[model samples]
Target chain A: MSELTPLNAIGEFALINRLQAGLTLRQPGSVLGIGDDAAIIRPTAGTELVMTTDLLVEGIHFDLSFCPLRHLGYKAVAVNVSDVAAMNALPTQLVVALSVGPRFTVEAVEELYAGLRLACEAYNVDLVGGDTTASRGGLTLAITVLGEAPTGKAVRRSGGKPTDLLCVSGDLGGAFLGLQVLEREKQAFMADPETQPELANYEYVVQRQLRPEARLDIVHELRELGVHPTSMIDVSDGLASEVLHLCAASGTGARVFSEFLPLANPTLEAAAEFNLDPITCALNGGEDYELLFTVPVTDHEKIKNHPDITILGHLTGKEEGTNLITKAGQPVPLKAQGWTSF
Target chain B: MSELTPLNAIGEFALINRLQAGLTLRQPGSVLGIGDDAAIIRPTAGTELVMTTDLLVEGIHFDLSFCPLRHLGYKAVAVNVSDVAAMNALPTQLVVALSVGPRFTVEAVEELYAGLRLACEAYNVDLVGGDTTASRGGLTLAITVLGEAPTGKAVRRSGGKPTDLLCVSGDLGGAFLGLQVLEREKQAFMADPETQPELANYEYVVQRQLRPEARLDIVHELRELGVHPTSMIDVSDGLASEVLHLCAASGTGARVFSEFLPLANPTLEAAAEFNLDPITCALNGGEDYELLFTVPVTDHEKIKNHPDITILGHLTGKEEGTNLITKAGQPVPLKAQGWTSF
Candidate 1:
């Protein structure tokens, strides 16, 4: 390890100076950035603003023993951005508030900011302003993202109508399986200090868990194809829970076909190794950061052949109830069973 | 104590349901509120958005021993709203994210939100969206405020000129003294649990510490009087510190007259009771949430005799340095002993 300065050594002002030195504003609406009582932005004319905030607690949301600081920072920003994309909006700015304990060094904070900057660069978003303070417990990250969409264009989870085709972006269960592998390796390392855990073969699943990407590309593609989703949500708390959210908000029921659920090969292999069912993981696993939406059946032609898109099922009347049709031709009531910290 | 529901008993979804039921939409721009992936708002045309975020950590920022949960919630929102007021903006919406430990009851969370809702209603700001989850340690609150100001009309800390008149609204040092009283009472209570704390004598100061109001009324008064501040900041970290911030940002210096400083009777009495200098408390104490600003010398006549406004001194060249002019005709360089979490 390199010699690094602890946060207290340089004090809060110096730390803020070091962090602000590398920021470059890329958003035209960002009239004024940091170094003020507040940030100033000019929302684009004729557009509406979309805002979302998410809090990630240390022990509850992640374990530092397995989660890298940089990846944790990236994931924090990505999850909030995912929420914006779920509204069919383009992310523009982010305000990140972080609290760290005494154990966190300035270099560790820099590594975390590096990941934040990387995400900003990838998503074309600007870091506007935030508050940084010392924590009494473990590290906590609270990120708020600002996005924009044309008036009347932003989607909502309550807009879905019966018979609308349900679709999902990317694959699921990879992140959950990835977490299982990391937990297993951590337990092994804890039990025997001399053991060197081999993880080369589990790279794909592990990376999914460490660094999930937001599906903003799908939002752009839908706009380009002139196909607007009637309703949308991000798959953060598992597909089953998110589907239930959509159903509850839209006052409709959903029929998700188990056969059409997307599952990557690495996820399946990892689930098997853990003696867990792959389908269950795909259905109930969380933190995939995928976009789930419903579009009119007539618009399916525009999205059907897309490589990253999968048609899960369609919306149904509220009387039908939300269910998952298994491959064995049995209907099971969809239970959320989302990851709950309480 | 009354019977209360544990957080786990009702679960996350049920808690959300209970909280959302009480929220009503007051902001016309709020196209979509909670129950969606993100909140949507349309800022009035040709207005710039002012954004600010603050994080308050348990044990670090406040002590639950004396700090009521409702007051903590109100203070969290007020502090951020104070930032918006410093920018000469009207607050419109807020996003509050909270993390609570398992020990917190559903009733406790509702008490916190009741305070939040009260603040929102008082400021006419909508509670648009947020995320709530479990924490490993104590309660944490992260609040982000969104406000609007006409383009090019928002005040900034860097707009002061050499001849600008330095001014502050309301009195100072009350909150700091209030905190001192609370700490002393808490120590006494800890020494003997049977002792009933007497707070009637310290009502004014105690209230200041528990519920500091954002000076939005001052922002409105300034606008109505046709006096646009050249530079502004909220007194969150002492008068001397905030003066230095304005000076550093504006590339100027300031001369504050100690005799002209505003000190409430309660603040002076409290400081004397602790055997601390009243002047020092007025200068170095924080969390007053008062507006400290500068205006052109030509506009002094318009604000000179305002009941709540005090003309502290005037800005000076950087070479002159920031100083506090004492009643004995002595000039002392101002020091920024602002609160530091680290």
Candidate 2:
């Protein structure tokens, strides 16, 4: 949307061109790219396609007050990539359906596309085709990411063994705490029109909210480590909630020590400053965008020495039930208080 | 939306569960459906897949004043299927990501799903996966449909020939006029709330808006008749605009007789009632969801007697340019003023 003069960034047809431009296909199977009634991609051989979709609403999933448009676009593609990643596959293409209110300028739309293009480059994805429409209300983005994995190789949440080690990549709760800090700062600004957000002390937490990266790098790293998780799900809804999904799908229980939870220094500091329980935030606050997977014990040694991976717990017998063990060895039931938009 | 009392629908989780429960996936490739991060489709034969996405925003693409939740859901699926149909492929699966506000309820979401499931059933498509989230504003729907065609056989809009006979299936502008009448009635109702809608006269046009069907049946029939369109595009954006696309993509021009443009009885009546030109509506107004294609003239004889197919004109050399020749033999320059939400 960068321009020298006053402009309406999202003049219906221009958005379609922006999305289709700069995307080059590597395969002949891409029968079509853009500017048509429908996009056509030849199905791959020896593999059935994996598909997933996500909708990100403006005021609900993000706020322009703190969340930059570029990062939001990146996160938008990243989360969809995470789904493809969670399927233990490599994403090859994407279709974006964008709806925006007239308030958005072409420059704003370009900024969003800049972030989206960045993700497409890093992930080696082609922006094939999509519909761009006007919204009567907010800016809404709906992305459908297409991925491919060898037939029968997609890791499902139901395949974990009772003895599998529960592991996570990167940290948890940063995005949640980041949201908290952003909300607090916005409130401060609203109370005093002249006041600016004072966020030097909470930079990391703020970054976590404004810009979140999916753990696709971990996906590649794990591929190099020669490990395929028996049961995998991303930390999208919150740790406890995702754990419940893995447990329910695998028909097992989880036992983890509270001390083993990973929390960044900034996250812990910000949580305490806000009078929040860091442990609870890590447990129930969502948007961590990390990888939560269960691997057979045999595969543990491969990742155990890795710096970013965290071995939080082990899959448990059903009779033991889904529980959280304290630092002092006490047991408590685990519950899923995931972020509910409705 | 059907519920007399909406207060009980506040908790969104229950509604999600209810919608998820009644639906079933019968696809052989579907390893899982609807309950996880993503659905896995074990593609057979590692074939080339066709993927397309369409976005529909409330107020822009639809009006709640006339479009029911059920028909909105049906139309959403239908339009996506129309894209797949344009490819001359068989639809196998779909993923729908939906955003709605609190005004919607458990039963309301179910009504929408019921309509979607009906389209899926009729079209032999499986509902593989989707994202359901809350919207801060009006409802938004993004549906991505996956289709399958034999390797090297998918049709595209860029393959038209200069001498190809331009053909169309069914009629046009019913949906457009349908929208016009709906908007008119909505205004009338705003002027006097005591009046019931005078909609019976516009029933067919209204149905075109409410329950537009994809031309998948025509796709099958074309195959049975041993016809492969030299070029094809769906008539979602109206006859003239689609003709322009077919010509532009093929580096050719099209000359169509406005006399040959098909119109449903209700569309003509509504146009007359509104003091509007039916031919203009058929030319520029969109959302028809019919098949518009160009077949080699050699193959036209084969389809000359086919009930649903109507030969309109022929593709011409680019030098001749795109034109709409009226019954009196006057050449009119064609401009594609398809519906623009912006």
Candidate 3:
């Protein structure tokens, strides 16, 4: 945000020291934080550790044209936090490995770390340790999040059973529409450098794409309500792909009701503007980062009235196969057409 | 090594499935390994967790011209493990995040995983979870390693006392010399496509460069010998840099005896061939992944006879400052000059 300083000017250790200077450990489990060969954490006596990693490469994962460095940094940590939430665990510590090309300035890196620090505080997770290195290509970030859940209480995608209610947290398809809006704006900007693309109407979708939050709240609320999910996963790859994942992992089939799929007003508006069906977008539009979990049918009433949750379907016998029940009573096979990395 | 198959042909999920199929959890702490949103681990009672991360960028940290994918994979994991060893911990689990460019094939990815698996077995650590994505440039790897040590037993870089004896594990400078040999061979190969590497005489150095091992054995031996290091760090950067880190962190100074620095015969030969000083290679030729530590002077006799360790020097009061006692008995201030990332 200020004067640009080449990374080479300060050197690696100096950069690390500068970035690590203001970090404070807030987690009780954090025995040591940063500045050592490794950070140390003392896990709670009866808790198990849930570890997940995500690698986000520039161009492939985000474009610098519309995606600010700060937002990219926040999203990187949030995505991994979402995975931890999917496990029904509370994130405790995180380590980041950042690789930056020469084009990046010290101030740019600080802004990215500022976003990371914000996420760390939001999640109440400690920034324990990390590696910072130079890259020959664009910026890349790899984050590994460590979380904890009561021993044997962490949910897995393979724990669902027949007759389990499939529930999803929050509305979907916003992130996908958000991407479409950004892409359109990017195209306009590219066509004319002086063009001031209008984006006021797309604020919600844009935020969904640029700064998606992890559904840790859903994990917390479920615990508070005395409801234990039979199986859980995050809607990172869309509702359809995640439901399929649950079914395959748990050896059960699911019937998702198309009409019951939650749609936010902004998402519907964006879908209409883009000439797309809101239901299809909700089903296959990925990067929502919402929690999708299955609870025993008996616990349905406990969470049914939750403001942010929607009961989308129920698990059935594996022989039934996974499908989406249309509003007209037709059964359509579900397919996983989520985002592909390669 | 087999018929090459493009990565996109099989898709991401299929690729993950293929890579994850044969993974078996060996660590008793591993409650779950792979396939879930996150891997789960149960730390042993009364032990603290040590975590560290490392990012390896293509072209910057390594050149694929002479570096095999498998060795690259192994080195990535080993380097993180080395950091764990630096904290006096036993590595238990690892997570990898890989970004590969379009030029890479699925089979090539398999080769990389094969190397990862080999390292996992060698280190007695479990390959628990990872993220794999396509890169827009050359391959990049980020690894996070988790290890455990008895409560309050894990060493830190800030624990050295003024009178502590500084020691190092194994011979140094070999890996640096190895890189030199490989780079020379790469140049020759590039100059004439028909050129053979003629690497018979430089096997040891070449291996050191391509596949450096972590010094976990030193950690175990120190434990068994009833000798605890006052301070410890991995010599990822050269000895000079690492010694300075110890001094700065411990609020003390150190005197490194150049004559006492251990250099293997092969390393010496390579240094001679390159017309470089063996001492300089040992001091500033990094990538050795050896352990640099300081132990209480009283415990020196216990480790002095150990085959792999060399007592390099002793810690000094802060006023003395860090310096290297040359072979000719002149004291010179030690400068890092280790490999710079930026």
Candidate 4:
């Protein structure tokens, strides 16, 4: 193990805060989120309920050598929230079950809760009941989030149409670029104990890696724009992976020109610093937590000039194929490596 | 590490099945309790919801050197359900998260889930959704459960009155004694690997430890009889500890005659064989999963003849103090050593 990547490292709570920061909550139904005994949700009569849960373990979903505990805590909730958001439902309550090794303490727990609370507040969620126990090894966080949509509006990954225009919100590849910077800094810090990490200049890239926000804003914006996605998913396992997911579920294919890919300024700067192509980072980077969906072409003119939203591509025949066009005009196939936790 | 205890050991799914084979589901709302993507639940409207969670980690909560995973899994959910039952509520849903090390296989996860699912079915709860992740070390199981009661009928720990008749459901000390049998068997097996774990003779005691059930039946009976508990709690952290919780929360003290302590016939047999006192086991051993509570004096007639219910004590003014009566007619102070996980 690298000296900088200390083994059996990380107190439980510190890892939590690294994952929760700078998010927004725009739902009125979210009465509570992230830090409490149990979340209390108030759903109108005739409304149904949906709940989902997920768990993340160190040495599995992340390497503390590169991942921070605060970010871990934030990601724990974010991933579950993403699942709820994928259902196209508004989230209201979350319960966390955390198991920490002796490597944790009161301070560490507070840090984790701080990040959890931040995420809950951003998503207009309430942190309800949870479990806390001591683990014999690396940190493990299990979160169950509760969501409520109107009586019959809970969207599934299986809901899409043949002519839906595949749309994506915000930019991708920024988080992947951010990870590159962190990994390099970690390597430099490991090479010499006295070396100071020069991360000040890569603020945006670092934020992408350390604190990726959930795309609830798009969920809300679409509702207000009166444009509902035929189907949707958040990019956690990578963009290509998510695209295939929408296609496979909707039984359709899609085509996108690489020139239209969204790239944050920081992404280009960071990729340049590392002497790497920015498009690759944008295409395959995971943890962006951005929304990927399909809307009818009629909705295209409705959001064509929108600043953050992008018309990445459009759905097609199942046999037509899912491919990305290069700016150099070469066609490239899209494949999802899928996140390997094993 | 006891040879029989299976130190750092996780059972394959088959063994887990064998372990859960002994318990039977006893509730009607237990739909799709254990083996599915997520447990499904159905609760009638106008019911108040009560939820609680508990997490158990190896080394911290149990020493596999002595504790078994099958038992641990069952205990984890049973204890939390007991909390809901203590409030005179019916458990409805459960979500389980487990983190495993590389030494385990899919079979092990299945076994753990089997135990968890068994408890859910036994208590009429749906499995709902949960997370499964990899752990860097020993087994970690975290479970959160949801329960329900009539909007205004859910009993709380703070409802006892000065003259309430304190009661306990079922015999105590068997589960505690069962734990002792397991510990002793572990020691004996460590001395001789060929031992078949002579627990057949101590079936009652061992079952209490390995497959304890929540007293949900008592809660239902009370409702049917039109009797409501003034205050309640499960006998999880020892009877003494639970009595104190009731007293402190109800703003009163308890006075009980030692002769009124209830112990199973099997518990007495095992106590004699182990050279132990059954009353001590009843008083201090945790994990009984039985309800310890108080009812208004006028309602005593409602449950007095109830087969499974036992009258153990009564509530009094703070000036009376919390006391335990000895078989010898002497008052004794109560001591609680809650399942020490620290």
Please, what is the whole-model Cα lDDT of each candidate in the order they appear? 0.92, 0.83, 0.94, 0.71
What's chain A's TM-score in each predicted model? 0.98, 0.93, 0.99, 0.86
**Native-referenced Cα lDDT, model 2:** 0.83
After superposition, the stretches of candidate 1 with alpha carbons farther than 4 Å from their true spots are none
Q: Candidate 4 - CAPRI tier? A: acceptable
Give residue B329's lDDT in candidate 2 (0 to 100).
95
List the candidate 3 regions with Cα displacement exceeding 4 Å: none
- Least well predicted 10-residue stretch by lDDT in candidate 1 chain B: B193-202
Error of 3 at A320 (Å): 0.8
TM-score of each: 0.99, 0.95, 0.99, 0.84
Residues A4-123, candidate 2: write the lDDT tens digits: 311243456666676557667765456677776667776567775678899999888888877888898898998998888888888878888998787776677778888888888878
A60: Cα error in model 2, Å: 0.9
**Residue-level lDDT tens digits of model 3 in A1-342:** 457899999999999999997789999999899899999999998899999999999989999889999999899999999999999999999999999999998889999999999999999999999999999989999999999999999999999999999999999999999999999998999999898977899999999999999988988899999999999999998889999999999999999999999999999999999999999888899999999999999997898899999999899999999999999989899999899989
lDDT of 1 at A152: 87
- Tens-digit lDDT string for candidate 3 (B68-131): 9999989998999999999999999999999999999999999999999999999999999999
Worst lDDT run of 10 residues, candidate 4 chain A, spans A31-40
In terms of DockQ, the best-performing candidate is 3
Q: Is candidate 3 or candidate 4 better by lDDT?
A: 3
Per candidate, chain B TM-score? Answer: 0.99, 0.95, 0.99, 0.85
